[model samples]
Target: MMRSAALCMALCLAMSMAACQPGPAAPPQSAPTSSVAGPPADSAGGATSPAVTSPEPPAPAAPPALSAEAQAQLDQELVAAAKANNVPLVSELIGRGGNVNAKDAIQDSAFLYAGAEGFNEVLRLTLAAGADVASTNRYGGTALIPASEHGHVETVQILIAAGVPVNHVNNLGWTAMQEAILLNSGGPRQQEVVRLLLAAGADPGIRDPEGRTALQNAERLGFAEIAALLRGHG
Candidate 1:
């Protein structure tokens, strides 16, 4: 009976010891870690760590089609300034990309208007702005023709000195020389013009549409001094 009791006690003690012992050392704990696959998320809701980016493309260029209304407005500004003989305004307009050789509705360019109106300063401006010396009016006359007919001696001198084709005949078959004689009397002013034109290599023999020479036109207009000048050339 004692042996039976002792065996029962021993079995109970072994069971208690096994229960208190740690089970299989609980499989060693592992530390938390990160991967190198990609950037980590930002806590502040901003860009991620090792942030990635790309270059932005350049802006587009301006279009080339000119609007009709804009073109008309530019033309109006240029014409008004030129016709008003506002040298500073005209220069300003030209500097702002205004067409120096732009023709008016009547086909008269700024240089033509300036020369015809005896606006010598404006004439100089337009010329320096690359105005074509041969730009014509509706009547097919150059700047020289009207200036000659109006006896603008200084304007004529300027035109000739600027390398205008002194012998150029218009569609009307009129040379500046003929206009200087037939359109106006070859008086002292016209006489000075003739001298200037002749000195610049004007062809006195060039005829008008009526086939009249400058000397003949001078004679018909009773411009004795002009006729004598032409005779000396002949």
Candidate 2:
């Protein structure tokens, strides 16, 4: 009986010690993993992951197909605009590819007709836009010839200063000075124009088919002042 009680007391002490001791920790589990391998990249929205961006499209080119009707309308407007001395409209047309030196059915470019009609502003504008100052009409009469023929001294002076040939003979074998002498229009400036042409190196002795010099034409037409001016230059 003593041995049995001793054995029971020893077994009860063993059970109490086992209950107080700490157990081995379960195997450490790996941290929750992400589906992707690397860290996320930054985005435009200030977010960790960014979206792909697309490229922008290019601009379209202007059209170049000009219709016949449109061209006719533009031509009419350009002619009228030139006649009216509408510098702004003329410049606009020229800027939009309109021809500043285009000739009409009468074989007159805008500049030629403008100079012929004494459109001084139009002449200047056309010249500034690259109009041919030396362009001749179908009759082979240049701007300077007509201007001088009509006794338009200012226009003639402009043409002369613009580098026009002062002695250009038209198809009728008449120089500007000869035309001035032959014409009986008797404008307010005929004598002055005759004198100007003579001063600008016009040969007073040049004869036409009738063998009449500019001085002879003046003499026949009774332009005493023009004749005197030519004689003085001679």
Pick the TM-score winner: 1
Q: Candidate 2 regions off by >4 Å?
A: 1-77
Error of 1 at 99 (Å): 0.7
Error of 2 at 125 (Å): 0.6
TM-score list, all predictions: 0.68, 0.64
**For model 2, how does the per-residue alpha-carbon lDDT over 16-127 read when each residue is reduced to its tens digit?**
9999999999999999988876645456544375567887887655335568777656655666788787878877775555556677677777677777767777787777
- List the pairs of residues colliding in candidate 2: none
Worst 10 residues of 2 by lDDT: 38-47
Instruction: Return the lDDT, model 2, position 220.
Output: 84
Candidate 1 at 108: error in angstroms?
1.4
lDDT of 1: 0.83
Give candidate 1 misplaced runs (Cα > 4 Å): 1-68
Q: After superposition, how far is residue 17 of candidate 2 from its true place, in Å?
A: 60
- Report every candidate's CA lDDT: 0.83, 0.76
RMSD of 1: 11.4
